[model samples]
Target: MRLKQGSLLWYLYLDKSYCLLSVRNVKALVEYFHLLDVHGKNTLNDVLFYHFLHHVTDLKKRQINLVFDMLDWSAVGEIGFEQFYVLVCILLAHQNHLEEQFMYRHSRTVFDLLDLKGDLRIGPKNFEMYRFLFNIQKQELKDLFRDFDITGDHRLNYQEFKLYTIVRINKLQKRQKKTEENAERERSLCSRKCRIK
Candidate 1:
């Protein structure tokens, strides 16, 4: 909900990779063309209207529009952010609570940016959601995490691992964003605070 330096960085990174497609010559691309509405919604049309279509070449417009339409929620119109978020959560849950965990991790990062504490952990009431997230295809989270080996060894130190992992993730993401933004700004500016005179 609240965007902080860290969250902004994460968004920018994801945006750059998924939306921007790592286009080195950003002048050729529109920024918004890459956001996926939280629920696999039609964010592309919004971009087309607000940013892309005007800037991109005519040939690119038709191709982009077709792709955008296909990504829409109902194929009738675009999906809203909240809906997109929910759909993504549900899919990430994949029949269990993996989606919840993913959101919890994200929420924690948000909290860190706000410098406030929030309870983003899963509780008994929501345990069923986790089960639903991964159990659909006979996937068990316990085994999955075991395989993930959070410690990078063979066992998980549950009490210490995830918290550390999430915090480091948030920090690394923020740093990456700062680095990228600096590079982007430098790339955009042709002169170094010097007058043409």
Candidate 2:
């Protein structure tokens, strides 16, 4: 996967040397690098790389193995700091891109599957098929369909469905932000009380 230009990871990769130097704790990074170099060879062998990945990500064993295969481009059975940094940036960027692509593809696929008549809209008859795919209650489905239909035509078009998803995502993000702010405030209050005590 090509890294998107102007992305955070791409910028970091472009000036990795400067970024590394700007780190607040260069000693910690160097220590971490040595820890991953299990054989003390200033590089991570497959075993050390596996442990390093496990420490950094919650990826499954198979997924970690796949990453290992991809990053070991030199066929040298070991990885250096540069290779590790590049692989990390690429994977992070790839994951972000994949999430966006997946959401778009998934929505399109679901619309195609549910729009049985190929009429670019899902009507009552076609919506029956949607019930099998989604475990939503019938009344909830009706309410959602009504809300998403947008034109009040009693049918959901792809554009309308996409708009609904966008609105839902925005609302969810707002709620999540509010929740985080509340948690931070509580933490701040607790810390202040502890300091006072």
Candidate 3:
């Protein structure tokens, strides 16, 4: 239950004990985690670890909860390598991104999914995917620099580019989080209603 240094290495050996019905899903999750580890070398800082549930795959969470729900397995509310692997498997089995998208679009699913409203709280307006890379390149910046030149001078400095990138990422994250929260809230309400009814 407790994650330690040899966690991942140990899991590699132990996972063979359980027979998973869908091996492909397991492989996909494993690959996903591999990529995550590679890319998150720097991005997976202490902050990410502290909020590690965000990164966990659905499969992994169940395993952790079942095993370590009673124990303080995650000291900082974060799962380490072995715990991460278990969660990833659980995520693949239960967490359906497509389903989440559908629920968000059709109706806000829960507070953790998306917040369609302007409010930071979770709601339905958040799950719409309007952009494809091609659409972005074709429509939004068609002229690219038509209005970018503040003084009618056609050029962008390093500072301008840096600031733009920062602003863009922050905006996107905020919007996404809003949508996620909305969907999550909707889902929660639905479940509660179901239980009550």
Q: How many residue pairs clash in all the candidates, one count each?
A: 16, 0, 41
Residue-by-residue lDDT tens digits, candidate 3, 127-196: 1221120122433333323433233444333333234334444655688899999999999999999999
lDDT scores in order: 0.37, 0.59, 0.37
Tens digit per residue, CA lDDT, model 2, 92-115? 434443322222334665466456
All candidates in order of TM-score, best leading:
2, 3, 1
The TM-scores, one per candidate, come to 0.24, 0.42, 0.29
| lDDT for position 184 in model 2 | 100
TM-score of 3: 0.29
Q: After best superposition, candidate 3 residue 114: deviation in angstroms?
A: 34
> What value of lDDT does candidate 3 attain over all alpha carbons?
0.37
- Candidate 3 off by > 4 Å: 1-135, 142-148
lDDT of 3 at 156: 34
List runs of model 2 lying over 4 Å from the truth: 1-105, 124-140
lDDT of 1 by residue, 1-197 (tens): 11122321222222221222133323222223244233343353446332333332222445444433423536555644433333333332332223324434554322222221123333222232233322322343344344445455443343333553455447557877999999989865746444442
On the 0 to 100 scale, the lDDT of residue 79 in model 3 is 39
